[model samples]
Target: MDGIIVRRVIPSDNSCLFNAVGYVMDHDKNKAPELRQVIAATVASDPVKYSEAFLGKPNEEYFSWIQDSEKWGVVLTWLLLFYSEGAIELSILADYYGREIAAYDIQTTRCDLYGQEKKYSERVMLIYDGLHYDALAMSPFEGAPEEFDQTIFAVRKDRTIGPAEGLAHNFVKEQQRKRSYTDTANFTLRCGVCQIGVIGQKEAVEHAQATGHANFQEYR
Candidate 1:
């Protein structure tokens, strides 16, 4: 309760979610491939649970798509170019690791718990700023090294969530004040494959669908 909780930034190599989750789960940021395999295995082991209706695509497609390190996106109502994970992945991970994953959204300042109803003994925190995921950890003192930070907390530790939520609120507020998140609805993007300019998320989706180009880069 007396520790300083800080946001641990993760790389934006299109695997930030997995890396952040890995950091919070194991203090290892390079566990993306293993974690992806875990998700694939979990899904494969439960075809009925991770069916087309739940996965938004055929089970086989999602299995390969998630395993492919070069591929991304979760196929929500709309698609972003570099999305690595979503609620579905979070749920799978929660079950796989037997820990609740609390994701605090910077845009909405809402904490979404992946394994809320489950009986998990531990919980890990992640920060979501619309497009990227970062980890939250508690350090023993100010400016302490990351090696001393604690990323996982006991589920019954009522003190942990309070500080985590406070820090998340302040951090998200500051980020919002600076307009730090990409406005997917209105952000300008250029197709990396064909070098065609696209406006907004809808236009980007249309361009990708029409031209079969999945690569896109944001441009102001």
Candidate 2:
């Protein structure tokens, strides 16, 4: 076996923070602090405020254990910063077999988290980019075993760049496509960046080969 295993991060989602921060630390492992600062500067986010969202809500005991698990601490930290000030619309999870489940936990929790306040603005909408979470939560398959399905949360809904089922030859495509679409109130296509949408197939083939970064498998 390749030694990869997947599990649902629920029944108390303490692991989400760990996995998120670990990804940041590991992925940025080689970057020096100054270089990271340059990158962080481009992020346009406030780490301190975002960190607060990481502690959004967990029972004291479970929260402590999650913070203490060394394996995922860094990942969790990054995730907190990534989603800190940003409102969470929803989240999705998918496993090797491709069973997809989406949820509006971010929105629902925001309501419970913020709306309960006496003077909070009802104008604060959970604001879903799409209804994939609505569809998944409204789905009736939670009892299924090992079904860690949440691809939509991680995929783009655009006709260009990515649409999960669309062509994307790398993680850059996956992550960047998301940043392009879901991180804001709207998404737009960059003809220079994602010309694959309008260009002819053969032309796109030539364009993709121009970078030597794409393959047919990107569609699958």
**Candidate 1 local accuracy as lDDT?**
0.77
**Alpha-carbon runs more than 4 Å astray in model 2:** 1-14, 19-142, 147-220
Candidate 1 deviant stretches above 4 angstroms? 73-85, 157-160, 209-212
Task: For residues 1-220, write the lDDT of model 1, one tens digit per residue.
Answer: 5677688999877778888999999999988899899999989889999888777668998899888776553233134333333888888889889999988776667778888778687889898876678898888888989999888877664534555557656777776677766666777778777889887777877877788676777777
What are the per-residue Cα lDDT tens digits for candidate 2 across 29-139?
122233223323322243443243344433332234332433122222222233532223111111211222222232222221222222211111111222111111111
C-alpha lDDT values of all predictions: 0.77, 0.26
Clashing pairs in 1: none
Clashes per prediction? 0, 13
**How far does residue 148 in candidate 2 sit from its true spot (Å)?**
7.0
